[model samples]
Target: MYGPGDVRVEEVPDPTIDEPTDAVVRVTYASVCGSDLHPYRSMAPSQNGRRMGHEAVGVVEEVGADVTALTVGDTVIVPFSWSDNTCVYCREGFNTSCVHGGFFDGAPSATQAERLRVPQADGTAVVIPEGTDESLMPSLLTLADVYLTGYHAAYTGGVSPGKTVTVIGDGAVGLLTVLAARQVGAERIILMGRHTDRTDLGREFGADDVVPERGEEGIAKVMELTGGDGSHVVVDAVGHLPAYEQAYGVLRPGGTISRVGVPQYEEAPVGMASLFGKNATLTGGPAAQRRYLEAALPQVLAGQIQPGRVFDRRLGLDDIVEAYRLMDSREALKVLIRP
Candidate 1:
């Protein structure tokens, strides 16, 4: 990205193994994440464009001598960030906060390209079994960030059987949160979105209701749905302040608000009226993708869930700019990139 609204695809050098723990992956599938829109809309101009994209699934082309878990020719899911799996934070299910971890966005190589240099390969990449069906690639790619992120929101919100979950966006993450909430046993899933097509998918993913209204009206609709008691958990997939306000508004006393969307603003209400008096807990951050990948992978391989269905459009590498535009305009739910 060279500046806000300017995405240029220029040729760059291919990646190679750079460290003893690094591995080079030949990306087969990569996708534009909703979070990418943040920089797309407001990033400062730069002489050298930043590499975009973070979610990818690909084949390992080379591995460092010290990498024991992955070998050449292995297919792997590269999470949004890299980390040493043995680090204290990684062991505790917070790979994003690993002592030696960093995100792919500012790295020397990013997943949007045809190749990526993955640091800490053994700890960051999840190897897929050989001969897995190619059709599952999209689903597998979600394991890198989107699906796991939704799952993280529910996990942090303490979603469980007999609980009501209110997901505050109809984007891919929100739709998948509905799926994750259902998988984790949430009895009722309410989705807040204006788009019928996206909200329709949310319903297919197990949303019990969709609130097309916004602001106070939206909050009232959700509260009405919950019989004025509010929801047991509110997953804010949209990071703007309004989304956060809606989250608190519909949160049942003692319920949790989990925010998976990267926040666009820093200031928010945490005072008595918003949280303190209600004893509401605020949690969620960059997903522990490596940690959640373990459980989500098998389910995708088994065909029990098709989170990839969230992808509504497909574009080749050369059309990435259009892909971004489609998403920015809300014309595309999510776009799959074929490199």
Candidate 2:
């Protein structure tokens, strides 16, 4: 979104499976991501008129002959990045950064399109079990991105039972990070947000406290809720300079900060001062999709996790403009767009 309201549902050629390692998925549910909104707001328009989606859940319409693990009718979650299972990083549990076709190389394109060609099918697509309820699409679809990313944020931050954790954003990923932190057993969840709807869902999903402020003031609230030492872990769900500053500001000395926000231009500077002085750990990236989605699947199937709760509104692909605007304006928490 170079200026605001730049996304449009345009016609593109029907997608086809390009290789034995690829599969064409008929996207059933795709949601607007906070990261997607960055380009629409301040970043420039993509040069390729590219398809704009990274998170989606769909049925395998067609699979390459070599894609033996997935068959037609199998439902799957497409992660933000794609990777070949045999790659070096994949062997190291860093599937998002596989030696071949990593996040940048074979991203495939955004899930906002009607049909998406999933590259590296065996490695990147997490198949949802057969007979999964259709109503779970909104939640299951989230396993592709925000929810999984949230899981990674909490996972990397060392969130666990009895630990006090603070999350740094109220966007869908931030909201899901709260859910992840709670599911992982953070005794106290402090979510940072100014949106009533987001904070409300955070509480429902297990955030013990919500801060309706910004910057240092918000950090103050998180510290207050934690009785002044700050949380044992802080998740910087908002990927920006300000959010990074806030994450550093309120973290207890030595507490870890997990940053998952896509930066302003795919690259941006982050906290270096506090990270070094306090001897705190700061890590950021797209979630380890393959590593976490499998663990998260059963939670959704068992109905223990309602990751779909972040959807404040749902729309058809026809209303892409308004969907972009609502998310860009921060008027909606998460928007689910069906194709």
Candidate 3:
């Protein structure tokens, strides 16, 4: 990304193993994340463009001497963030907070390109079994970030049997959160989104109700659906202040609000009425995707869930600008990039 609204596909040098723990991956699939839109909309211009994209699935082409878990020809899902998995935080299932961890976009090589130089390969990449069907690539790609992110929201929110979940936003993460909630056995799931196309998918993913309204009206609708008590958990997949407001508004007194969206605002009401009075918990951040990748991979491989359905459009690498435009304008829910 050069600056706001200017995304380009420029030729760059191929990557190579740069550290003892690093490996080079030939990207087979990559996608434009919603969070990428933040910098896409407001990032300052740069002399040298920022390396964009973090989600990817690829074949390991070369590995450093220390990379024991991966070898040449191995297919792997590169988590959006890289970490040395043996850190204390990683042992506790918080790979995103690993002492030596960093995000892919922060590295010199990013996943959007045809090749990526992955640091901490053994701990950051999940190796897929050999001979996996090519048709399942899209689903496997979700394990890199999207599906695990949704699961993170549900997991952090303490979503489980007998609880009611209200997912705010119908984007890929929100819809998948509905799926995640259902998988964890939530009794009811309510999706708040105005787009019928997306909400429809939410239902298929297990949302029992769709609240098309927003603000006070949306809150009221959700409250009514939950028998006037509000939901046990509210997953805010939209980072706007309004979405946070709706979360607290429709949350039951002791419920949790899990946010997976990249927040747009820094200040929010955590005051008496918004949170403290209800004793609600606010949690969620960059997903520890590596922690959940192993568990979710089987589900995708078995054809149990089609989280990849969130991708509504596909484009080649050269058309990346158009892909960004499609997603920014909401013309595409998500775009799959073939590089």
What TM-score does each of the candidates earn? Answer: 0.99, 0.93, 0.98
Q: Best-fitting candidate, measured by lDDT?
A: 1
- lDDT assessment of candidate 2: 0.81
Q: Write the per-residue lDDT of candidate 3 for residues 65-164, one digit (tens) a residue.
A: 8989998999999989999999999999999999988998747899889999999999999988999998888888888888889999999999999999
Estimate the TM-score for candidate 2.
0.93
**Collision pairs in model 1:** none
Residues 278-307, model 1: lDDT tens digits: 999999999988888988999999999999
Clashes of each: 0, 6, 0
Give a tens-digit lDDT track for model 2, residues 1-339. 223456667777878878889889888898788887766766555655445767788889999988888989998888878888677787777787787655522244557878888888987788888898988888888888888889999898899887998888888888899988988899999888888877888888888888888887887877777788987888888778888878878888888888888755454434466777777887768788788777888988989898998888999989978888888888888899888
Q: lDDT winner between 1 and 3, please give it.
A: 1
Model 3 ranges off by over 4 Å: none
Top candidate (TM-score) = 1
Q: What's the ranking of the predictions by lDDT, best on top?
A: 1, 3, 2
Number of clashes found in candidate 1: 0
What's the C-alpha lDDT at position 111 in model 1?
A: 85
